[model samples]
Target: MAKWRGPRAALAVAAGAGVIAGLTLRTAEYPGMLPAGTPDPELGLGLRLVCAAAVLIAATLAYLTFARRQDEPLAMTCLPGLVVTGVVLRHLVVTLPGAARISPAARIVPGAGAWVLLGSGVVMTAAGLAAAFAVRKTA
Candidate 1:
């Protein structure tokens, strides 16, 4: 059996950390960060779905990395990138003129959840890239 070492191990750790961070963001609410009104239901649902997808991807990455499976590192790299894209899209949706007109509360600044998601994505991406590089060097 191949031992977990180097970049593969690091990727697994990073993925696990992302999963934890995403879960924390889901449960915790930041008061006063959002305006004193209900947020756009569709936008909110989209954000939640994106977060859920990220968490799932991270979990899968963690498993594959821990197992030392190197079959699809490149494809794995895209998972974190997708998470980052989702976060960016969420920001755009909140800040767009149409969003502001739909709900004045849309002007509210992003809360801890946004920051956590961004950070998690960054870490996951970095770790995935490092693992991919290691895989290339070995192959």
Candidate 2:
């Protein structure tokens, strides 16, 4: 197995953590009459399910990669996290532009979690690609 396997495994774990953190954190913050700003994930039912499903699949792939020292499973691990990131970004893209037009007091802003989720997805995908292209030496 190539030496990069160890770091790739770590990347899988980090990506899993990123998925959890992203769902737990706010997707967007809106200024309002409430003391604390309104957050998209404050209504957590749908997001909770999405987060759980992605993390579970990613964990399984990570285990398969570690146990077998196989790059294929590691590459597969990238899918779940990336899907979540895509969904989140799509929501933002489809919704955010007209959100602030509702009222002067109603302004939606991207939250820290959005950036973290995006970074995590990018890292996971890059690691997967590297694992896919790694060279195996002939005996």
lDDT of each: 0.54, 0.67
RMSD of each: 4.8, 3.8
Worst 10 residues of 1 by lDDT: 26-35
Which has the greatest TM-score? 2
How well does model 1 score by local distance difference test?
0.54
Q: Write the per-residue lDDT of candidate 1 for residues 31-109, one digit (tens) a residue.
A: 3454445443233556666666765665666666556566354337546556764664556454444445655644544
* lDDT score, candidate 2, position 7: 89
Give the least accurate 10-residue stretch of model 2, judged by summed lDDT.
Answer: 34-43
Error of 2 at 26 (Å): 1.3
In candidate 2, stretches whose alpha carbon ends up further than 4 angstroms from where it belongs are 34-44, 135-139
Best by lDDT: 2
Q: What is the alpha-carbon RMSD of candidate 2 to the true structure? A: 3.8
